[model samples]
Target: MILRQFLHREPVAASYLFGCGGNASAAVVDPVGDIAPYMEAARATGMRILYVIDTHIHADHISAGRALAEASGADYVLFEDAEADFPFRRVKDGEVLELGNVTATVIHTPGHTPEHLSLLVTDHTRSTEPWFVLTGHTLMVGDLGRTELASSAEDGARALFASAQRLKQLPDHIEVLPGAYSGSVCGRSLSGKPTSTIGFERRFNKAFRIEDEEQFVA
Candidate 1:
C-alpha cells in the first residue's frame, strides 16, 4: 500500500492520496482546491484515481471533490446517510473497499457531523492488522472536532462520544491522520504537527480521557 498526504497551509486542511501501487489504483480523501497536486501524484505513481471521498460536508473551505471525480472518472463517495444534492456512491457502515494489497474499511464515526466517516486502513502486504486511521475530523492530535457543525452542540457531542468509542477499540498502535490541524475552525485545540497515534491520543486527549458521557457532553 502507498499513501501520500497533501497538507494545505492556508486553512490547515490535509488531503490524502493512497492505494496499492501494484494494482495501479488509488483514492483521494478530503481534497481541497487546486487538484493539480493529486493529479500529478497519480501520474507520477502511475495509478488511476478510483475513489474520492469526503469525511463530511466541509464548512471552512471549498471542496474539490466533484471536480476531481469528474476529471478522473472516479467514484465520488459519501456516507449512505448523508443528505446531499449531487450524486455519489453511498458507502455503508463497515463496508470494506479493496484495492489490490490495500483495504479501506469505512467506519461511520459521526460526531463533527451526523454523517462523518473515518477510514480504517490496512496494508495487507505489511500485516493483516490495521496500521493507521484517516480520522477526518473526528479525532485529531490534541483534540477532537467541534461537535456543533451539523447539529445541536449537545446532540453532536453525544454522538461524538459514542463514535470515539469505536475508534478506541482499535489497537493502540494505529497512527491517526486527521483532516485538519491547528488554525482551522473545525477543532479548538488541533495540533500544528500533522499526525499522531491512537494510543497517544487515547491517553492524553481531553475528550478521549472523559469516560463519563455527561462530562463529555458538558
Candidate 2:
C-alpha cells in the first residue's frame, strides 16, 4: 500500500490519498480545495481514483470531494446517514472498500457530526491487523473534535464519549491520521503534529483519556 497526506496550511486541514500500489487503485479522503492536486497525485502514482470520500459534511471550508470525484470519474462516498441532497455511494458501518491488497473498513463514529465516520485501513500484504485510521474530525493528535457542531453540545458529547470508547478498542499501535491539527477550530488543545498513534493519544490526550461517559461529557 502507498499513502500520501495533503496538509492545507490556509484551511488547517489534512486530506489523504492512498491505496494498493500494485493494483494501481486509490481513494481520497476529506479533500479540501483544488481538485488538481488529487488528480495530479493519482496520475503521478499511476493509480486510478476509485473512491472520493468525505468523513462527514463540513461546516468549515467548502469541500472539493464531489468535484474531485467528477473529475476523476470516481464514486463520491459518504456515510449512509449523511444529510446531503446530492447522490453518493453510501457506506455503512462495518462495510469494507477493497483496493486490491489494501482495504478500508468503515467505522461509524458520530460525535463531531451526526454522520461522521472513520476509516480503519489494513494492508493484507503486511498483516490482517489495521495499520492506521483516518479519523476525520473524531480524533486528532492531542484532542478529540469539539462537540456542538451539528447538535446540542450535551447530546454530541454523549455520542462522542461512546465513539471514543469504540476507538479505544483498537490496537494501541495503530496510527491516527486526523483531519485537522492545532490551528483548526474543530479541536481545542490540538497538537501541531498531524499524526499520532492510538497509544500516544490515549496516554497524553486529556479528553480522550476520560473513561467515564459523565466525566467525558462534562
Candidate 3:
C-alpha cells in the first residue's frame, strides 16, 4: 500500500493520497484548493482517482475536492450530516469506500464540526491492522480540535468529549494522521509531525489524558 501526505508549508495543513499499487486505484483525503499535484501524482503512478473526500467544510482554506473530482471523474464525498450545498456523495458512519484493494471506513466524529468524519484505512492485502486513520479536525497530534469554531464552547466541548471518547475506545496500536499540524488554528496544540500512533498519543496527548468529561471540557 502507498500513502502520500502533502503538507502545505504556509498553513501547515495536510492532504493525503492512499492506494494499493502502481497503476491501481486511489483516493484523496482533504485535498487542498490546488488540483495539479493530486492529478500529477495519480498520473505518474498510473492510478485512477476514485474518490476525493473532505473531513468537513474547512473554515481555514477552500477545498479542492470538487475540482479534483471533476478533473479525475471521481466522486466528491463529505460527511452525510454536513450542511453544504455542494454536489457530492454523503458518506455515512461505518460506510466503506473501496479503492481497488484499499478500503477506508468512515467514522462520524462530530465536535470540531457537526459533520466531521475520520477514516480508518485498511489494505485488504495486508493483515487486519489498520493502515492508518485520516483525522480531519476531530483528533490532532498532541491535542484535540478546538471547540469554538463551529459551535459554542460548551456545545462543542460536549460533542468533542463524546467523539474523543469514541476514538479512545479503539485499539492503541492504530496509526493516526491528522490534518492540521503546527500553523493551523483548528487544534489547541499540535505536533509538527504529520503522523502519530494511537498508543503514543494516548500516552502523550493532553486531551487523551483527561479522563472525566468535565475535566476534558475545562
Candidate 4:
C-alpha cells in the first residue's frame, strides 16, 4: 500500500491519500485547502483517485473534498445519513471500498458529529488483518473528540462511549491515524504526534482508557 499524510497547519487538521500502489488506485480523506497537492501526489505516484471521502461535515474549516473529487472524476463519499447540499455516494457502516489489493472498511463512530465515521484499512498484499484506521476526530492520540459539536453534550457523550467500545474490538496492533493533533480545537488534550496504535492508546490515553460510560462522560 502507498500512504501519504497531509498535515495542515492553518486548520490544524490532517488529510490522507492511500491505496494499492501496484494497482495505481487511491483514495483521499478529509482534504482541506488547495486540491493541487492531492492531484499532484496521485500523478506523481501513478495512481488514479477513486474516492474522495469526508469522515464528517466539518465545523472547523472548509473542505476541498468535493473539488478534488470532481477534478479527479472520483466519487465524493460520505455517511449515508450525512446532511449535505451536494450529491455524493452514501456509504453504510461495514461497507468496504476496494482499491485493488487494498481495502477500506467503513465503521460508524459518531461522537464529535452524528455522521462521523472511521476507515479500517487493510492491504491484502501484506496480510488479511487490518493495518491501520483513519479515525476522523473520534479518537485521537491523547484525547477523544469533544462531544458537543453536533448535538447535546450528554447525548453525544453517550453515543461516543458506544463508539469507543466498538473501536476497542479491533486488533491492538492496528495503527490510529487521527484527523487532528495538539493544536486543533476538536480535542482537549491531543498529542502533537498525529499517529498511534490501538494498544498504546488503550494503555496510556486517558480518555480512551475509560471503560465506564458515566466516568467517560463526566
**After superposition, which runs of candidate 3 have C-alpha atoms over 4 Å from their true positions?**
none
For each candidate in turn, give its C-alpha RMSD to the true structure in angstroms: 0.7, 0.5, 1.2, 0.6
Predicted candidate 2 versus true structure: per-residue lDDT over 1-218, tens digit per residue: 98999999878999999999999999999999999999999999989999999999998889999999999999999999999999999999999999999999999999999999999999999999999999999999999998898999999999999999999999999999999998999999999899999999999999999999988998
Candidate 4 Cα outliers beyond 4 Å, as residue runs: none
Q: Which runs in model 1 stand beyond 4 Å of their true positions?
A: none
Candidate 2 whole-model C-alpha lDDT, 0 to 1? 0.95
For TM-score, candidate 1 versus 4, the one ahead is 4
Ranking by lDDT: 4, 2, 1, 3
In order of appearance, the predictions have TM-scores of: 0.98, 0.99, 0.96, 0.99
Clashing pairs counted in every model: 0, 0, 0, 0
Worst 10 residues of 3 by lDDT: 123-132
Residue 191 of model 2 has an lDDT of: 92
Lowest-sum lDDT 10-residue window in model 1 = 204-213
Which whole-number lDDT from 0 to 100 does residue 154 have in model 3? 82
Screening candidate 1 with a backbone cut-off below 3 angstroms (N, C-alpha, C), the clashing residue pairs are none
Q: What overall lDDT goes with each candidate model? A: 0.92, 0.95, 0.86, 0.96
Can you write out model 1's per-residue Cα lDDT over 1-218, one digit (the tens) per residue?
88999999777799999999999989999999898999999999989999999989888888899999999999999999999998999999999988788999999998899999999999999999999999999999899999888899999999999998888998899999999999888988888899999999999888887888998999
